[model samples]
Target: MIHLRSLQRLTLAQRRRTATGLRAGTILLAAVAATLSRAPAARAAPEPVKVVVVANFENGADQGDAPGEFQFWVEREHLDHPVALRGAPDVLRRGRDGLYGMVLRHGVTDLAAFILDPRFDLRRTYWLFTGISGVDPRSASVGSAAWARWVVDGDELREIDDRTVPAGWPYGLWAIGADAPNRLPSDPNHFGSVTELSQLSKAFPLNAGLARWAFDLTKDVPISDDDAIRRARAAWNGFPAAQRPPFVLMGETLGSRRYWHGEPRTRWAEDWVRLWTGGRGVFVMTNMESQTNQEVMRTFGRQGLVDPDRIMVLRTASNFSEPPPGVPVTASIGDEGPGQRLAFDSNERVGAPVVRELLAHWTRYRDAIPGRP
Candidate 1:
């Protein structure tokens, strides 16, 4: 009886050992399978294709004001590739300001979204922003279109009261001249001083075909009518020192009131321009009346949308300069009215030629630059 009981106990112990081995094997197999399943998912995603984004313009005449208006027209009329319109979100969110935020809000919600969204190919896309900017009174006249070399936030400068306190500003007109060799140092408040694609032949290389196309398209378009020039010069002659708007005052005031105090504006301008030019661009606008241009351009640069070499700034005349003591005074011609109206319309009419040139240039640039497409 005792031998039989011991035999039974040994048999039970063997069974228990077998069961323990089986359970251990099962657990080990499950862990190995789980690890293998995650391997593919852990791989990094591919880079997204570059895309140009144009947002709806906030101000100006609705007809020619929106960035997308010109961008869509140009893509349809000029580019051979697909151009997609990004939707604008209504909810105002924080952490997005200037042109970067505008592109994010209106075109693509985020850069990552642009990368992951099935609609866009990660490896083959790019973007550009196209729109009109107010000409600096000192340098460029009304009706002239310019490409940015650099975009600086006018509000980033120091200010006092409602005026921009210029003592330690990082991106004032003076700083612009110090950076760009082609720019003249005379007028600091003017937008024309910003470096443009036309001027930066080396660092921000221009596609010769593109430059030729831009020149050809814009060449025939009259920059100024004789009558308009006469009127502008006449208006300047008439304005007295006390009545004339000061250029420095314009920059200072714009920096203090509009850009510094409020939610950052001007992201659309920066993003679109940066995308179109492949990352190097600049902007020009009145410091006092419209920092929108400056703010937007600056935002694009900061966002990595633009290539660093392709940046510059330019300004026209300073509205801040006081006229001579005895000059006759007339109402300011700064506003875009009847005379400026024709300039915007002319873009639509002559845009075909410009489109042709742009396409040709883009093709040539793609060919010249090894990795661009």
Candidate 2:
């Protein structure tokens, strides 16, 4: 009977220990689950984009074809991933280096469509607008590149036929509210007054410091100069700036839907840019899309869709805005001359470094723009 009681006591003790062990395990598991439940959830990674290269057009296949504004970039950058937007002619491409390139149509419509699409986010994006344009002979020679400090609109103006313009008027084109050419329109504050743009403004100033930075970064980079280029530049004898070899500079751009040529029109562009910018801007390049593009970007900026301060415009000189000495306006207007190829080469040479710099130290430039305090 004593042995039986001892065994029974031992069994009871064993049972108690077993029950306590199980309860402790259960409590430990419950504590672990509670802690996990209180912890924050893992967040999705942000969409990575270092730089977005906005090119105007492409000539052929993105690779293994004759180069265009977009082709060299696509090929050189190894932009292999293609994302096709439905109902769009060009495909958006991305590289593993966090670079995105898109060949936007020549005007505002396509850019607006791309920006409005829900497929991508661009609020943190940096835009580099680049293309070939008619270079003002007084500013820079063909094959030269200009970082625009201001983009002036040449289309929103009043014009009469140059032949029928009143005597002493340089050209028929003038500000919408102005009574005469070369005159700034009255301020909108004036009673019953039509002003420079009425309710709209003509000049869109880009980041001046940024332009200077880009110009400084690329100004020393060698531009393409060949026998063809030398021969083409030789014709600009009277214009000292145009006779020089290609280079990089800071200048302003004038954009219009209509393509106009001739010495008189060139003078008009120069004066128009100066008037709109309150004499702070100098016209250097001419194109068909910049004003419209800047307008769309400004609207997007107002809506919080983009940061306008991050935008940069780089235009290389594909041709002269007006004829060389003794060349007919019609002949010179149609010919891009040898500078076309030189411009293409110069654009890539000058733009690639800026892109690379942004990419190399993305941690710094991702939030802070270069040349800004």
Candidate 3:
């Protein structure tokens, strides 16, 4: 028989081993539980959304965050895996495969809020700014669409009343560092006089390759026509492109905050863009948001959040910037008729195909950004 002390020692040793094994098993289980809990968060992060459409309002109606003039792009395109974006002034709607859209109120402030929102991962995103704008009757008709090469800010200028303007000046408005209206300094680098706009808001030019690529994709796609649009085009008799049915053409934009209208203002827009672009651009679309959009992009671009070069602005004509040949400005402003609808429809008409092409060939462009001339 064994001694009691030795037996007790043997039993103590067995109990110690059992306790150690149990502790190890418990620790392993705890580690597994911790890992399992973290899986949900990893799954929750959404995939990156590409191809964002920037729109301001509903074509006719707001269909519960979608099917608006901007939202329609989501449904018609059948975008998938949509997730509502957070950390914005308002939640922006985003889709997984390709389409994403945001509705901005009519100003720089509203657009700035949305662009500065932290939740969006705009890196590698291709921003498509689609909106309805007043058309320059000289450049396009009521339903003509122009792909902008230069987005010129129309608000920044020195102005005198037209009645007291200097002789030979086209209008009251004059760009800084210039002798008179329509006169821009020959040297872009050195202006003899220091001007307010020299450092403030001025102009942004889109990537020529991308703008041209877009035009090539949609140039031949026939624009939808209707009675109202046809009647509007009839008034643009002298302008060959405008007289033809609604079509896509490459042009430029003038963005202003004042909403100034009339024949004189339109002439100013043309000259302003010409001066800013060194007479290389023709003003076709008059809009309110292009300058605002670029300002936001410039910030994001430095942070590597968005590629400013990839951003493209596409404007469709909703009304004439000035009255058609004989129509009075006051009467024309209120009577846009069906061209409003056509403008919305035409944006999608040209925009949709280019979007489709990108989606269809995702493999080629997934890692590489397109638009090389």
Candidate 4:
């Protein structure tokens, strides 16, 4: 049974096209409000932060101990004017130099409101979404990281119960205007399908050039793996990516709040990302926050509050969305281990270098995109 509150919020966003998929019928969690107010991010016309590090949640022991996401990004920098936004708690950290950091509450509402906040000077900043997510076992393993080239929304679709779906149907899901799975959506532009490609019915493509540059810089960085992950990965000895030690890769991501799992859902995620990107994107990570974040950018991009070209998303594998060959989905759903720590470590490893570069040469990046050296 779907949560009434979840469905209610979804309905609200669809009705109010620009609504931040939050506050439709749901109350904003205090966590979201408290996070941004912790420091007090403010400034009428203060110096613009060059880079902003965005992390979704602070859970587990690593997160509890660290001052912020990726640890060093916050500890090493000095933040000023922690202006708290009313609709959401958007804590902005001004690096000891010129960088910034924010820990986002795990929801679409806060994500959208923060950018629209008057205090955020996104014009001269590089918004880097740094977080961990579930990886497709066929594509990656714990500790592996990916730079997203495209972000697809998997939630905007019509569906029938699997039990009542027609024969040969993959699942009960299909495009909003399409007749069946894998078919062209009839009303691609019904709402905000303006960018829908022939193959993708609901999606957004970030700056391809920027994604390439980030991938090129960190593709070869050595990713540390551990015995816990190795032993966990042993269950998937047949899958090359899952068996190999963690590494960095360039790929695409999908975001949805449904949190479905197992092979069928995994296949849907892969196909959805591929179909949306028209075969150019490789699907790897599954996220819950990116799609909402993208929506906010798209909404404000028109008002000159945001630059879609200046944004990038980085995802690291904390666990597989589905169990391996023999493990059941039920067992894998709640199984816990060191994947959390590995995810934190790898996310920082793959993303820190880029953050450092932007901080070191803020003058060059403030007015221009950096070229690959």
Candidate 5:
């Protein structure tokens, strides 16, 4: 019934509509494909830790065992969450409070690994290194605690046989590039031909202001004391500091792998710390691991994994570095007696307050470090 021209015009209109529909479908498919391609892959953010309590070792289990450097912290802090460290058997425990405690055994390597672990975001975490040290009687009595400004390494020295050292030289240990004992090396970068010690000096300085802040904050905390330590303190006659009851002080720590004991060695530690710190530091405590740990921390800091200025070293006196008058070095070397318990107690009492304060003021402290203007 219709004309041929009208039928042809209708077919052309239908073709144009079909073409528009296909073009629109193609544009929508392209957009959807592009959106799918540009979508981000799923990823997890790193875990945040505000405070890390770095303890050297623990006596036994993490809980319900004889207390070690980590026990009182774990027990008192209620650090019940056990997070297994990747590639290591050790566990990093956490508390409901923003505190993390780990007892490191393989000193530097373990610490370095912990810091480099991708699982933790430690950029703002503060490190509190707490341990018992052989207390210098001249610095403090047993059970006393010291906030350290410097951790001087007693290792990394050239040693000749003490019996063969030149006359008047106190001990065999001397700087790597120095000619005599108690002397500084002209160039810190070179550690002889055999050992390349780099420019990292033996003196590992902590934030002086922070150390003072901690000392002032807890100086009045009642340090635990016992009759055995009291009686032992009496043996240190003529040494005024040793004779006094346990109290907090600001002092430096001398760390050496060798557990050297005796009056002569004590004198060496004193001189060594003074020598390394340019006489600005005095040796008050002796330990086996501070230097290694601090050195690792410094490296991590440089790597942007941590803030080195936030590090604090707190040493409680478990025993005297040297024997008391009339006691043989061999006899008193390993006799911590009641001083160990007192030191443990002091560590908790003195350290807990700082931890609590940090937690309470995290809103402010999270951005601004304490003792900084």
Candidate 6:
């Protein structure tokens, strides 16, 4: 009988040779097919056409409005053309994880073409991201829409050296705006890169109306009474002067245990918003959970994926600080849910105008952007 060891060696060698021969033959066949197929060389894959929508649980106080508004604008209006709107897989929520899976499912890589192929769009299509974010109470008011010069996955995080310095030590990955005029000037040790959308912004500044509409919708909403806003500011004030982070970072999706403090996972679902809408803009709104303001902006400043000039972050103040001693604090902000009208009726009225504005912006910006379909 043949020795077992010798037999094994012979089998392995034969497998390797067969594999090599198969590869060679495959290449030969491909060459022949290419010649026979057509006179012109095969064209590169079409450029990826995508957009992103964020359903923040912040400002609107109800998650319902965010998703509902996105569906109406993206599916009903913008996507009325021949393009397709791909649905992302449902996120897995369990254990200590909250929105962690949601973020990975929606991060830059999980986006349409990125999920399919980083170079999915070589020539056609576009990607867009829409959603809500919190604005600095000092700088922005409730319902006002603002665009990001850069969008930092405020929640998605990595480790950093737990050391303090005069200049500030940097550690972590931040996606900056592709079209941002200047790179973030903070820490030099952090990981930063301009995103694909940022490049598109340079060619086209994105529809200005989307930002305008967000402003219109929330412009009148009272921010003085919201509890979240009151508490967030208080939290900021509570921080020691030396420990306070420079910029305010706010997003509903960031506070969840899943992303801000979780393991490596796919943020694919969130990426769907990008695939459906050609990259146009990024929206920052509010959510139920309160998060560290400095942390939020630091994340954005680090990434540089969004254009800071175009960034719109809108926040409705839920609560204002009470006056001390004999002073009385009046309720300056409006209620969270549907204001005066019935919930359904109010949503339709308030949301319709916003949608219309978005469509108008899309038409103007889409046509203006270079390399856009």
Question: Residues 1-373, candidate 2, lDDT per residue (tens digit)?
Answer: 1221232234332322221011211110001000011113563443645688888877777778777888878888888888655334465788867888888753444555455444567787788898899988988988898999999988767888989999999989987567898786665633353443544568988988877887888889988787877887778888999988888889999988789888999999999999889899999999887886787687678767678988999999988889988988988885674666678778888898888888888898878888886
Q: List where candidate 2 sits over 4 angstroms from the true fold.
A: 1-48, 187-199
Each model's C-alpha lDDT?
Answer: 0.30, 0.75, 0.66, 0.70, 0.76, 0.28
- TM-scores, one per candidate: 0.40, 0.83, 0.78, 0.81, 0.85, 0.32
TM-score, prediction 5: 0.85
Q: Model 3 over residues 1-373: C-alpha lDDT tens digits?
A: 2321232234333322221011211110001000011123244443455677777776443444424456556556554343432223342565546567666643333443344333445676778888888888777776678888888877656789999997777788876556678775434434434444544326787888888888998899877777877876777767666677777899998887668778898888888888888888998998776766666566546556568777888998888777667777787774555577778778888888777777678776666767873
- 1-373 per-residue lDDT for model 6 (tens digits): 2221232234333322221011211110001000011213555654332222232222231223554323333233333222221233332111110101112233321222122222233122222233333222333333333332223223323333334322432323322321111222233333344333332221112334444544445445322223432333343333232122222222222222232211111122122112222333232323322232222222233333222232233232221112212322233222333211122222223333443443445555333442223
Model 1 misplaced regions, further than 4 Å: 1-116, 122-127, 162-233, 238-284, 287-334, 337-340, 346-354, 360-363, 367-373
- Would you give me the overall lDDT of model 4? 0.70
Ranking by TM-score: 5, 2, 4, 3, 1, 6
Higher-ranked by TM-score: 5 or 6? 5
Per-model root-mean-square deviation over C-alphas: 20.2, 20.5, 17.7, 6.9, 18.9, 16.7
lDDT of 6 at 144: 33
Which tens-of-lDDT digit does each residue in 113-171 have in candidate 1?
A: 23222333323222333333443333334444443333332332222342343554322
Q: Is candidate 1 or candidate 4 better by lDDT?
A: 4
Candidate 5 local Cα displacement, residue 218, angstroms: 0.4
Which ranges of candidate 4 are over 4 A from the true structure? 1-44, 60-72, 76-90, 106-120, 188-201, 371-373
Question: Model 2: which residue pairs collide?
Answer: none
Worst 10 residues of 3 by lDDT: 27-36
Residues 63-138 of candidate 5 have per-residue lDDT tens digits of 7988878888889988888766543347478886778888886454456446645567899887899999998888
lDDT value for candidate 2? 0.75
Over 4 Å off in model 3, which ranges? 1-46, 59-61, 64-68, 79-82, 87-91, 105-120, 185-201
Instruction: Kindly report which residue stretches of model 5 are placed more than 4 angstroms away from their true locations once superposed.
Output: 1-41, 187-189, 192-200
C-alpha root-mean-square deviation, candidate 5: 18.9
